[model samples]
Target: MKIILNGKEKEVADSTTLQLLLQAMQLHPEMVACELNLNIIKRNKYGSTQLGEGDCVEILQMIGGG
Candidate 1:
């Protein structure tokens, strides 16, 4: 399946959950925020949230420096 990840096109497995995708990308959920298809997905829901083809996903990493 193809989806737009952070404005770039990418292919992912069918029926991929947000949690799985994050793991595949080696991303730590605790340090990032995810928005799926224009909606912000709650961290607790990552395990259950399924990503579909053509979905637009935005992953923003949290950075703390002051």
Candidate 2:
């Protein structure tokens, strides 16, 4: 299946959960905020939140510095 990830078109497995996707991309769940289809997803729900085809996803990473 295809999904829009951070404004880019990307292919993912069927019934892929947000947590799995982040793991595949080598991203840490605690360091980034995930939005699916314009809705912000809670950290605890990542494992249960399944992504559908053509769904828009945005992953914003947090950077700390001063």
Q: What is the C-alpha RMSD of each candidate to the true structure, in Å?
A: 1.3, 1.4
**What are the clashing pairs of model 2?**
none
Off by over 4 Å in 2: 64-66
> In lDDT terms, which candidate is top?
2
TM-score of each: 0.92, 0.92
* Residue-level lDDT tens digits of model 2 in 1-66: 999999999999998999999999999999999999989999999999999999999999867878
Error of 2 at 28 (Å): 0.8
Model 1, span 1-66: residue lDDT tens: 999999999999999999999999999999899999999999999999999989999999857778
What are the per-model numbers of colliding residue pairs? 0, 0
